[model samples]
Target: MANNLQIASAAYIVMHLLTKKKQSSIKKRRWWTTQIFRSRQLYNGTSMIRDLNFHTDSGQFENFARMSQEDFEHLVSLLTPIIAKQTTHFREPIPVNERLAVTLRFLATGESYTSLQYVFKISKQCISLIVPEVCQSLIEVLKEYVKVIINTFINNSK
Candidate 1:
């Protein structure tokens, strides 16, 4: 009876080892799953702008946005409070700098929604939602600045 008990214990150990080996050897094709694919989707906000050196490369940045970096900063500062209030704490708020850059790119280049998505690594739905919101915010924030610039331009032309 002792030998029988020892044999049963050895068989159980062997079976457990085999099960672990099989589990480890099996290649999981988890990369093909929707969850994995979704996780791999690119997200570009503040870092994208920084990586592209929009702050440092004044010439390229101005060419892309049709506005100087100083003006861009001013616009972002003006719009920050409004956009900040609109954003909730539920999810990460896209930075005011990114929103302003994306809006300026769209307005300056007349780029399509699809193109903007590729450029910004943002979803089409989000881009569509953001563009209008930023535009409206810009109108509200820059109204006074626009008036001053227009007045200066008219006076200079005289």
Candidate 2:
């Protein structure tokens, strides 16, 4: 009878441990999912993009993004149609200018996506996606200028 009780107790302890382990795993998963979908408002509120009045501070803007404000605005205008996203009910889309700024900063600084995420309040995943998409858009939109430059160079050489 004692041996049976010991066996039963061991079985109960094993079952309890398994239940606790499952619960902890579920909790971890919930936390991870919440993190993935968490609001960017907190980060955005303190983000460099929001805090810096770069428009008024052209020098600072140039330092940060490696481009003058005028050129930045021009790029934004040219790229907006290609990069712009529609706002959804869940969240407003990131602005075109912000996307361009992030891409330019990445190009200028060669900062890791993790660091950029902190500065821009955008997820690294989003940054990774934004950088490549913006770069491709820039190539497509700027190919005409490249061609003109190449043609001028060849003509001048001749």
Off by over 4 Å in 2: 1-39, 42-47, 148-158
For model 2, how does the per-residue alpha-carbon lDDT over 1-158 read when each residue is reduced to its tens digit? 99999999999999999999998876433353245336566666225654566658647677777888789889989998898999898687888888988888889989999998867778889899999999999999998886547777889998
Clashing pairs in 1: none
| Clash count, predicted structure 2 | 0
TM agreement with the true structure for every prediction = 0.59, 0.66
Off by over 4 Å in 1: 1-43, 85-90, 147-158
Best by TM-score: 2
RMSD of each: 15.4, 8.8
Q: Global lDDT of each model? A: 0.75, 0.80
Which candidate leads in lDDT? 2
